[model samples]
Target: MPRTVSELMTPHPTVVEVTDTLHAVAQTMATQDVGSLVVAEGGAVVGIVTDRDLVVRGLAEGIGLDAPVGQLASEELVTVGPDDDLAEVVRLMREKAVRRVPVVEGDQAVGILSLGDLAQALDPDSALADISAAAPDE
Candidate 1:
């Protein structure tokens, strides 16, 4: 089993500027086939935006797509280092009630560790692992 986040995390995760519009964020997510994006400012990770944010906080709230993504981005972001222990990361995730955490190296986002990554790496036989491993439906 992978012992550290670096071993299981999805590296080179898609990133977007905080000033990017919701429409841009949505397009990036669609193009990248990712549910979450690391929001950066001046090359530093500042926040994270998820597909859920687009719907619940943007569309449902009647926020126009032209609005900046920072409006819906979770600014009080939680992060982890690539070398952090997987167990500790899992604990932090549960405590923070967050599903995804950006892995940073001196303010630069190197990767993203997600619940799906944990499930797939730590328990390959689990249902979540199976689902996470399955290809996305077109």
Candidate 2:
């Protein structure tokens, strides 16, 4: 059976506004136990902010916690469709060097598919799972 991105995606991912402070975004991530947040504006996704983005783009650049996430978020989003083939989406992820891609229906973000999701779906015991789940500096 051909699987789909929706089948493996984490639905209704935690979200925050583009104007949200980094502190608030971090709090949401920690509370949700998610590594990334869908950056939204007027209920429509505009970008994505990940923990790595916080470190590499926010802290490393000396951007204060009170600053708007829009400054550090990835404005050029690479997204996928819910019905997209899992294999094709995986290929896209590798080609684009993205760990996660939002699953969009029109302009709305309905879910997110991460490399970890693929690892678990394709091979639950694969080493990718360990690497994907590993905490930074581990």
- Specify the highest-lDDT model's number: 1
Which parts of model 1 are misplaced by more than 4 Å?
Answer: none
Q: lDDT per residue, candidate 1, 73-117, as tens digits?
A: 996799999999999999999999999999999999999999999
TM-score between model 2 and native: 0.90
- Candidate 2 per-residue lDDT, tens place, 25-44, comes to 99988877778988888778
For model 1, the run of ten residues with the poorest summed lDDT: 68-77
Error of 1 at 89 (Å): 0.4
